[model samples]
Target: MLLKPGRGFFFAIVLSSVAPVAGATALAVDPMTVLIREYSRGNGSYEYLNSGTDESYARYILDRPSSPYANIKWSLLPSPDTPTRRAIESVSTQEHPVNLRDLHDMKVWDLGFTKAHIASETFRMPQELRYVPGAWSIVKAGIEPDIYAQAIRNQGLEHPAMTANYALAAQLLRAKLAATPPSLWKIRGLRHDVLDRFVGGEFMLAHDFHYLIQFLDGALATWDAGSTSAYGFRQLPAPLRLGRIAAAYRQRLPFEHEPCMEDDTHDPEHAGEGTFDRRPLCFDDATDRAIHVWYAHELVQELAAIHDRANGAPTLAERMAAPLRSSRQGWIGIPRPSAIAEVTRIEVVEAKVTGQLLVEGDVSYRDAFGASRRALRLSCGMRP
Candidate 1:
C-alpha cells in the first residue's frame, strides 16, 4: 500500500508482529552484520550500532533463524493509506494468493526506503562481522531480494516520503532501461568498450552527461535572481586546457571551500556539530575526452562537406559554418589525447548499506600515470 503523510505512526502499530524470512542458503552471514561493520569503521564510533536500546530489539528480530518471506496482508488493517493501497489490499484478499515469485519481472515495482531508517537505527554488527570472507560472493549470486523483502516487511510503510522516494527510484530505473543499447553488436568495439549496453543504442557513458545537465537545469530553475553567480551558463563542460583560462571558469570556483551542510544531514549524531568532513567534488575526466572526441569527428565531417561544395569559391567563414546545418555536426572542439592518457589506476572501496547489498564505494583514479590525479566517491544509488 502507498503510504500517506501523517498516517505512518498508526500504520506501524498495526503491523508490528510480522516475522522475518529464514533459510536463505545463498548468504553466508546476515545483511545486518555487514551494515554494522561498515558504519562503525567509517564513523569511528563503537556505540553507533552496538550499545543502544535499538540494538537489543534488532538482535531479537534478526538473530532468530526463520524464513521472513510472507505476502503482506494489507486487507486486515482498518485503514489503508491511498487508492493504490486499496488495489494492493484487494489483491491480498484473493482466494489464490500472490507470492514474491510473481513480482520478479513485474514492471511497476515499489521498494519502500523506510526500511533503511529502521535498519540503520537498530542493527548491530555480529561479533564475527569481519570474518565473513564469502559475504560479497553470496550477495552477487542473488541473495539480496529476500533480505530486502524482510527489511521492508519489518519497517512497513509509515511515511509518505518513503513512497515518494521509491517512486523517483522507479522512474530513474525505467529511464535507464529505456535508454539502454539493444545489442552489443551495434556499439563499436565490444572488446574495447569500457561502458556496458543495456536496451537501446545509447551508451552508458552518455548517462552521466544527462545527469549533469539535469543537475544544472534544476539548480538554475530554483536559483535566486539576485545571486552573483552565473546559473545556467555553468552547465558548459569544464575546459580541457589546464591554463589560467580553465582555472578562471572551473565549476569548483562556486563551491570549492563551502561546507557541505547538505550531505552532513545524513548523519543525525553530527547534524549540528559539523563533525562530518566534506570531500572535494572530482569531475570525470573521461567525460571530457568523450566530448572532445565528438568534436573532432564533427570537424572531419565539416572538412568533407567543404570539399563537396561545387562552386568552391565561398569565403572561409561560410565553409567553416557549413556543419552548423545539422545539430549532430555541431563543433565538439579539438581532440585532446592527453586527457585519455592521464588515467592511471582505478580502485573500488565497497561499503554495506543494509546488510543485503554492498553499495558503490569510492572510485579513485590517479591521473597522468600517477603524476597527478583525483578521487571520486560514488553512491550505490548512482548508476555506473
Candidate 2:
C-alpha cells in the first residue's frame, strides 16, 4: 500500500496508512515531500535542497525563524566556520552556484548544513535535518506508538515546519517501532535526549504536544473518531491562537501594532507586505536578543525565501560579506516569498516546481503588491 512512483493522492501519503506495518521501505515513492507538506507548506529539508527543483537551493539550511523554539538548535550548532563562511562570502569563483550538490564539502554539521551527508545510505540519515522545530515536532509526536495510530485527534496547526518535522520523525519512529519496541522511547540516548530537549522546555508548548499525543492515543482506543473513552482525550489542549503569542511578544518589541492581540489570525484583506507582517514574526526585544514565533503559514513563506536566497549563491554571498558599519540594524535578507497562496497542491514532479504554500482560512500576512491569497497552490517536487 505504500505509494508507488505514479500512484496515490499526491500529498495524501502517510506511512502507517499506506500499508500494513511490515517494513520501513513500505512505500515505493519516497515519503520525503509528503512529510514536509505536513508541517504546513513553509518548511523544506536538506533532502529537498539536494532535489532537482529550482527551489532546492541553499539558504534555508535551517528555516525556523518563524517558530519560537527554532533558535535553540540553530544557536547550538557550530557557527558556520568563520574562514569557510568568509570564503563563501568572498566568492572568488562563481563557477559553482553552491547548490545542494555543491555542498558535499559541507560534511561536518554547521549552522547551515547537517553533519550527516545528504546522500548517505544510513536510515538515520534524514533528507531534511536543518529545521529544529520540525525535527522536535516529529520526535514529540512519535514519543509513543498509539499516539500515531490514532492520528485524527492531532491537528498539527502551528509551527512553520513543526508538522512536517513531525511527519518525518514519525515515519522514522514507525520504522524503529516496527522492529524495536515502544519502550525505546524510554531508553536513554538520541531519542530520549530529543524528548528531554523539547518536553523539558516549559514554554515551547510542551504540554500541547503531550496532550496531543495522549488525545490521539486515547482516540485510537475507541473505534469512532468523534468519540473518545479516556478523560484525558476529553481535555484537549487549547487551540494554538497566533494572535495572543504575537501580542505577548509585541509587549516587548516595537511592532507597528501596539499591545498586539492575544488571539487572532492574519487579515489578508488589510495587511502589510513584510516579514514582520506575519503571525509568527521575529524581532529582537533588545540588542542580540531575537525571538521568533511561527504560525503555520508564516513559516511556509519564511522557509521559501530562505531557500531561494541560498540557491542564488555567490551573489548572496557577496552581500553577506558586506560589513555593517555605523548605526546598526540586523541584516534583514528575507527575499519576497514566491507564493502567497491559499491552497497548496503537493506533487512529486521534476525540478521545475518550487513555490510558497498557501493555507485556506488562514490570513495572508503580506500585502497585495503582486500577491493574492486566492485559491493559490505551490508544489515542491523531487526528481528520482
Which one is best on TM-score?
2
> Per-residue lDDT tens digits of candidate 2, residues 257-291?
43213222223333232335544332211000111
Compared with the true structure, all predictions reach lDDT values of 0.23, 0.24
In angstroms, the error of model 2 at 93 is: 70
Stretches of candidate 1 exceeding 4 Å from the true structure: 5-76, 81-86, 89-192, 196-384
- The reply for model 2, stretches above 4 Å from the true place, is 1-190, 200-254, 259-297, 304-384
Alpha-carbon shift of residue 350 in model 1 (angstroms): 31
TM-score of each: 0.20, 0.21
| Local distance difference test, candidate 1 | 0.23
